[model samples]
Target: MKLNFLTLTPKATVIGLIMGLLIVFLGRGLGLFFFFMMLWFLVLSAIVSFIGKKYKLKRKLFEDTRGIKNVIANGLWPFLLVLAYYFLSSNQFLKYALIFAFIGSVAAITADKFGSEIGVLDGEPIMLLTLKRVKKGTSGAVTWLGISAGILAAFLQSLVMLPWIGYFGSAGISMLWLFVAAILGGLAGTLFDSILGYFEENGKGNKYTSNFFASVFGSIIALTIFLLLF
Candidate 1:
C-alpha cells in the first residue's frame, strides 16, 4: 500500500517527526541495539498505518487531522516506557521489566489497530458480549479474520524485539516470555478497546478517552505478567 505523506496534516506530521526523532536519539543514547529496535518498532507501526489507510478503514483516529491526536495518545505509553528504561537502566531489577513493558505496549496497540482495521472488512461481525451479528466497524464487533490478524500482529511485534532478547543473553527464555506477554497484552488491549468503544458508541465517552484507557490497560497487563513471571 502506498502511504501519501501529503495526506497527513502539517501539524500532525511535524509532531510525529519530532516524536520519532526524539525516540531515535534517546534510544541511540541508550545503545545502538536499542536504536535499531526503536526504529524497527516505528517502521512497523508506519506500515500498519499504511495498510489501514490503503484499505480505507473507517477508524477516525487514522484521519489526517485526528490522526495527530491518535499518534500522541498511542505513543505516550511507549514513550514513557522508554523514558523509564533510560532512567532505570542502571537498576538491574527493573530494566528487563521496563523493556518487556515497552514491547508489550507496542504489541497491544499493533494488535488492536490491525484487528479494528482488518476486522471491519469482514462481511459480518458479532458483538463480543452479545455474539449477535453486527455491522462491520460497529463497536465491540469481532470477526475471525480480525482475531487472527490481531494474533499475528502481536507475534510480529514481539518477534521484532528478539534482538533485544539476544542482547541480554537469554534468547530462548526471554523469547518465550516476550511472546506470551505480547500475545496476552495484545488480546487484552483489543478487548479493552472494544469494551470502551461500546460505551463510547453508546454516548458514554469519547473515542479518545476510551482509547487512552485501552492503551493503559494493555500496557499494565503486560507489565503485570512480566513481574509475575520474573
Candidate 2:
C-alpha cells in the first residue's frame, strides 16, 4: 500500500515531520518532557480535514492560487514566531510560550473547521460577533454551534499541553485555564479570520501581515487572561 505520507505534498509532509521532531523531542525533551501536543496537532488536523471534507463544509475562501497564496502568506509569521520562541527563549518561559503558541495556532486553524462545518450544516445563521442571526458563511459571520465546536477543538488542543505546563494536582485548574483560553482564543481568532476574509479583496498582502500579528496578540491575550484568573 502507498504510504500515508505519499498522499501529502512533499512540503507539507516534510514540515510536519520536522515540526514534530523539533518541537516534541529535541526542543522539549522526551518521555516525561516530550511535547506530545505536536503529535495530537497532526492527528487532529488530519481528522478534522477528513471530516470537514466529508461534510462538504470546505469554504472556498481560498481557491487554487488563492488558497496556496493565502496559506503561504498568512502562515510565515506564525511559523517564524514559533521557531523563534523555541530557539530563543529560556527554558522556563520557552515551555510556556510554546504551549501558548501551539494553542494559538491550533485554535486559529481549527476555528475554520468549526465555523465552516457548523455554519454550513445549521438551519439558523449566527452572528460572528454578537451571536445574532446572520448570513451563512458570511465574512464575520458566526453561529452558536460553530463557536461551541471551536471551543471544543481548542480545549482538546490545550489539554495536550497540561503535562508540560502544569502540575498533576493542578490539572483541574489547568483545565479551567485551558478551557477558557481555547474558547476565547478560538473565538477571537475566528472573528479575526472572518475579518481577513472580508478584507482580502482590497489588500490581501496587508491582511496576511495582520493575520500573524493578530494571532500573536490573541495568544498573548489568552495567556495573560489565564495567568490573571488562575
Candidate 3:
C-alpha cells in the first residue's frame, strides 16, 4: 500500500527540509542518520494519513497547528535529543537511534489517539484535569480511555527503545540507562502533551508551554534515570 502526504502544506515540506538539513549537519548517527529519519517521517506521514483516511482518524493535531509550528512543537525536542546524543555520547548512534525515534513519534501519535478515542468512548462530560465528569471534549477532561491511551502511548515508545537496549535476563532489570531513560522519557512526554490539552481546556494563554516543559521534563527524567539507576 502506498500513501502520499501531498496534502501536507508547503510549510510542512519546508519543516522537513530544515530538519533534513539539521540531521545532515548536527545529527551524529552516520551519513544516513538524517536521511533515514527523513524517509521515516515521509513513510510514517503517509501511513498515518492513509490509516487516518480509512479509519477517519482526525488529523486534527497535526493539522491545527501551522506546519512550522507543528514541527517545532512536535519535532524539535526529539531532534535535539538525538543531536545531543550524537555529539555527547560515545555509544554507537544506531544502537539507540530507533529507540529515540520510536519514543518521540509513537508518544505523539498515541497521545492523540488516547485523547480522542477515550473521549469518544466515554459519553460523560470530562474534566481534562481530573478526568471527572465535566463536559465532553472539554480541555483537561480525562477519561479511563485517556489514561489507557497514555499508557499505550508510553509503552509502545518504550518498546521501540527496549529491543536494542535490552533488560537483564537473570535479574529482569535494565542493563542500560537508555532503556530506563526512554520509558520515563516517553511517559513524561505523553503526559506533557495531555497537560497541554488541559491548558487549552482551562484557557491558559500559552499552549506550547506544555510541549516545551514536557520535553525538558522528559529529558530530565531520562537523564535522571540514567544517572541514578546506571
Candidate 4:
C-alpha cells in the first residue's frame, strides 16, 4: 500500500472509475467522501497482502495483482446499496443506515484480507466449526490469529467513520450505536465468509462469490442493527 502509483491493470482502473462515477451519480456527498476512502482502502489492502511477501510467496499464499473481476467482486455490493439509496425511499434514516452498510461491506472484505494475510503465517489452522486440525488454505479452516486479525481489521475499518460521527449525529444517527453496527456488521461478514468456505471447498462457489456474498451479508447485518436502534 505504498502511496506511489500502484500498477493497476488498465481494465481494473477503468472499471474502478466507472463504479466510482456511478456511485457519485447516486449520492454526490457519499460519492466524494468514498473516493478518498476507496484509495486508502486499496493502499491498505495491498500493503496487508504484502506484509509477509517472501513467506507468502514461498508458501503459495501470495496475493496476485487483483484485476477487473476482483474489482467487481469487491465493488458490486457497495454500488448496489448506493443505488438503493438513490432509488428507494429517501428518508434520512434509510440513507444513514445505508452509510453504515457501505462501511460494513468494505470492512468485510478488509477483514478477510487482513485475516488471511496475517493469519496464514501462524502455521496452525483448524476446521472452522469442528476444530479439527487442517492444512493451511483448507477451505473452512481458520486460525485464532486469523480470527483476531479479522476482528481487529473490522474494528479498524469502523473507526474510519468516527470523524463523521458528529456530522451524522446531528441527523439522529447515534454515534455509539452506529459504530457498534459497523463493527458487528463487519465481524459477521467475515464469519460468514469463513462459513461459506465450505461451499467453496465443495465447488459451489469461488473466492469471489464468497467475498461478494460476505459483503452483502455485512450490509444486511448493518441495516438490521440500524433499524433496531433507529
Tell me each candidate's TM-score. Answer: 0.81, 0.66, 0.63, 0.90
Model 1: runs farther than 4 Å from truth? 1-8, 25-66, 170-173
Residue 113's lDDT in candidate 1: 72
What is candidate 2's CA lDDT for residue 218?
50
Give one digit per residue, the lDDT tens place, for model 2 in 56-150: 53544321112333344434444555566657556655555555554665565555555655555556665444556665555555566766766
**Global fold similarity of model 1 (TM-score):** 0.81
In terms of TM-score, the best-performing candidate is 4
Which residue ranges in model 4 land beyond 4 Å of their true spot?
1-7
All candidates: CA RMSD (Å): 3.8, 5.0, 5.9, 2.6
lDDT of 4 by residue, 1-230 (tens): 42223435667878888888888878656675555445555766777877878988988878757788888888888888888878752687677777878877887877777777788888778777677888787777778888788888777776666767677778877777766776777778888888888778888998889889988998888888877876
Error of 2 at 5 (Å): 4.5
Model 4 TM-score, 2 decimals = 0.90
lDDT of each: 0.69, 0.54, 0.51, 0.76
Off by over 4 Å in 2: 1-7, 30-35, 52-81, 91-98, 124-139, 162-175, 201-214, 226-230
Clashes counted in candidate 3 amount to: 7
Expressed as tens digits, the lDDT of each residue in 1-230 for candidate 3 is 33324434576767767776776666554424434533543444343333334223442423322355655655676676657656655664432443344344435443444444444445564654576666555555566666665555455444443333332233234534444455556566656656676777667734455555555566556555534543
Better of 3 and 4 by TM-score: 4
Model 1 per-residue lDDT at 200: 68
Candidate 3 regions off by >4 Å?
1-7, 30-66, 90-119, 128-131, 159-180
